[model samples]
Target: MKEKMLSFHDVKHIYHTVRGEVTATENLTFTVEKGEFVALIGPSGCGKSTLLSLAAGLLTPSEGEVSRRGSIGYMLQRDELFPWRTIEKNIRLPLEVQHRLDSESLERARTLAEKYGLGEFLQSYPSQLSGGMRQRAALIRTLAFDPDVLLLDEPFSALDYQTRLLVTQDVAKIIRSEGKTALLVTHDISEAISLASRVVVLTKRPARVAAEHELCFDGENDPLRRRENKQFSEWFELLWKELNA
Candidate 1:
């Protein structure tokens, strides 16, 4: 069996606003095994992003446990790259923040950039890159620190349809190639099915695990190819009903 990389055990989170208290999750339990790609999907304001925050250790659960075995990298909805910084500099931000910007780490970042087709654009600022390219750079930045797991919060939502498709494939490929486990929170069903090995559906506010489908596709595991599979539409229909339930 695969070792567990991250797990949420009967977790609950309540936001104590001045207005009152609001519970976002209740009895939420799930696990992302090492090297597994899992996507969490639900209705708007259903606490999907809150789950990512919990996994990333950015927020403490009000009850139960959120356990992680290693470090985490987060990819936000936007590229979130600094306009003034070059691609190289942006990718190096994590290391800089951690005060580990040594020559070896810098070289690792450079190698990742080159491996992902961003070598020529290392000196280029974020504004010079296309949307898809910028997202790729953002992913490389997240991977630069070699985090054991990646938390993606609708990383492709900001792109146009065309760009989103291309970048989704790119990000999926990069994550697989690097053998990194990922937990993605996306509202797009097709996007979730395309990139994840498992699709986890959550209920509305006070989110709980509604259902989970383990995906298996013949031939290539590429996101684009997965979309073309005969099973894709069937899976989509099933998930659609679950999401609406």
Candidate 2:
């Protein structure tokens, strides 16, 4: 059996406002194993982001628990790169925050940037780089802290369709190369199919696991290439049914 890296047991969440109470999630339970690539897909307002917020400890569950084994890195819909900071500087921000900013760690971040094709632009400001490059820098920043699990909340949603495809491929290759576990929440079914080892479907509002699909592709694991695989259409059809069911 796979050793679980994180577990959500009977998790439930509710929001209380002057307007009324909103039940965002109920009986939400799942397990993420070490090095697993899982994607969460659901209709809009299905509590996907709420689930990530809980995992990041940004929000407390109204019931049950969200438990994790190690550090977690969260990348939101926007790259959220600091405009004034250079690519390298932004990448080193996490290390600085943790007070672990030493020569070795900085060098590690530079090595990752270089290994992932961002070396030459290390000193470049965020405005100097293209959208895709900025997103790459953001990912390198997230990984610099060496988090055990990565929570990606539609990291490519802000980009143009073309840029989204390339960045998605770039990010997936980087994560797989680094052997890190990832949990991605996306509304794009095709995006989920291309990136996930296991795709989890959630129901509308008060989100709950509706179904889980494990995908297999014969080609290289590149996100774009995976979309061209024969299994791609099959998986897409299956998920389409599940989502609209």
Candidate 3:
């Protein structure tokens, strides 16, 4: 059996605002196994982002437990690349922050940039790169530390439709190639379906697991190719109804 990398057992989170306490999730339970890709989707204001925050340890559950076996890397919606920093320096930020910027680690970061087609642009600033390239750089930065699991919070929502499609494919390919487990929170059902091996749907406010779908597509694992599958529309409609219902 695959070792579990992250698990949420009967988790609940309540935010204490001056207005009052607001529950975001209740009795949320799920497990992300080693190298698994799971996408989370739900209605607007359904606390989807909150789930990623909790998983990243940015917030603690008010009840139950959020357990993680290894380090987590978070990729936000915005690339969040420092405009003043070169792509190389941006990708190296994680190592520097962790105080692990040894020569070996720096070499590994450079190799990853090259391997992912950013070899020529390492010296380029974020402004010099396209949105997709910047997001790629952001991902490379996240991976520089070799985090065991990646928590993606709408990482592609900022891009144009075409760029979003292309970047999601690129991100999916890179994540799979590295054998990394990822938990993504996306409002786009199609995006979730294309990139995830499994989809977890949450209910409205005070979110809870409403449904789970295990996806299977023949042939290539590419997100673009997966979108063309007959089952893609089927799954999309199914999830659409689940979200609306």
Candidate 4:
């Protein structure tokens, strides 16, 4: 059996504001298996971001459980790279935060940056790189700590349509190559269909799983190529109906 990297079981989360208590998720349940990429899709204000926080342990569940078996890395909607920091410094930030900054670790980070075509740009600042490259650097920073699972919260949502496609391809390829389990929360159905081997759909606020699907593309793992598959539209339509219904 595949090892489970993360699981959310009957989780309920509430935000207590001065106005009142607001429940974001109720009885949310899902699991991300080792080396698997799972995309989460739902309507607007459906607490998808809340779910990522729950997975990352940034929020406590009001009810039930949130379980994780390994370290987690998070990449938010924006690249969140400090503009003043050079690409190399941005990548090494996590290592410093985790206190894993050492010659060996720094060397590994450098190797990763170079291996992924960011070597030449290491000395460049975030402002010096294109949007796609900034996102790439953000991901590498997240991976610098060697987290076992990745929680990507619409990491490509901020990019233009064309850049989104290319960045998704780059990110997915790197995640697969590194064998990291990933849970991506995206509003873009097409993006989800292209990147996920499995997808979990959530209902509107007070989020909960409404449907789940396993995607098959004859072992095609490339997100860009997957979009070209005939089945891509089929999955997209199914998900659209599910979300609308």
- Whole-model lDDT per candidate: 0.94, 0.91, 0.93, 0.93
TM-score per candidate: 0.98, 0.97, 0.98, 0.98
Best by lDDT: 1
Estimate, for each residue in 1-245, the C-alpha lDDT of model 1 and write its tens digit: 98999999999999998999999999999999998999999999998888999999999999999999989999999999999999999999999998989999999999999999999999999999999999999999999999999999999999999999999989988999999999999999999999999989999999999999888786457999889888899999999999999
Global CA lDDT computed for model 1 = 0.94
lDDT by residue (tens digit), candidate 2, 1-245: 98787778899899899999999999888888998899999988898999999988899999998899899999989999999898889999999999998889988998999998899998899999999999999999999989999999999999999999999999999999999999999999999999998898998878888998777685367888888888889989988898888
Please write out the lDDT profile of model 3 over residues 1-245, one tens digit for every residue.
Answer: 98999999999999898999999999999999997899999998998888998999989899999999989999999999999999999999999999999999999999999999999999999999999999999999999999999999999999999999999989999999999999999889999999988899999989999999888786457898888888899999999999999
The regions of model 1 sitting more than 4 angstroms off are none
Tell me how far candidate 2 lies from the true structure as C-alpha RMSD in angstroms.
Answer: 1.1
lDDT tens per residue, model 4, 97-141: 889888999999999999999999999999989999999999999
Which candidate order results from sorting by lDDT in descending order?
A: 1, 3, 4, 2
Give the lDDT of residue 81 in candidate 4: 96
- Quote the lDDT for 236 in model 2: 90
Tell me the TM-score of model 2.
0.97
What TM-score number comes out for model 4? 0.98
Error in Å for residue 35 of model 4: 0.8
Q: List the residue pairs that clash in candidate 3.
A: none
